[model samples]
Target: MSEITPELVRHLGELARIRLDDDEVTRLTGQLDAIVDNIAKVSQVATPDVVATSHPIPLENVFRPDTVGEVLTTAQALQNAPDAAGDRFRVTAILGEEQ
Candidate 1:
């Protein structure tokens, strides 16, 4: 089993800028040791022939084709605007900048 010492935990806490009490450090030592042991077990089972994958199941792009479809005209789009210029929507100037 991998050993997670209190000194290691204290060093890690300092590096991460986290304050861990003595009780927390003691608890984390056992938890981190268990995690490392599990990882070691997994490494033993993972042979070179086995392929690595991010997900258990296969994945593919599910997006629809980008085909051009019927769209609204400028006049139709600007019809609901509170203020409209020649061919676009108009809004109040921001940041004290002149248009």
Candidate 2:
């Protein structure tokens, strides 16, 4: 016996606020039945002793350890700026405010 039927597909379409015509209902019924059969086949192999996993092989992090690195000083960083104000970059007011 098939697990999915045309009536069930039509009911599902109604629940999802979709209008399934007769042809769509007939096609979906067969596709859903095949999906159900595949799921059943997978369930049969998933025994208590078998472990479920997202991947077939083991995975490990490939990132290097986080550590502090050499960086430029404040004066060196602000040397190339067109304008500087007390160890900070200075820019013209952009919000139409009085400087």
Candidate 2 has an lDDT of: 0.94
What is candidate 1's CA lDDT for residue 1? 36
Query: What TM-score should be assigned to candidate 1?
Result: 0.58
Per-candidate clash tally: 0, 0
Model 2: per-residue Cα lDDT over 1-99, one tens digit each: 997989899999999999999999999999999999999999999999998799998998799889999999999999999999999999998889988
Flag regions of model 1 displaced more than 4 Å. Answer: 64-99
Any runs in candidate 2 off by more than 4 Å, and if so which? 64-99
Models 1 onward score TM values of: 0.58, 0.61
| Model 1 poorest 10 in a row by lDDT | 1-10
The lDDT leader among the candidates is: 2
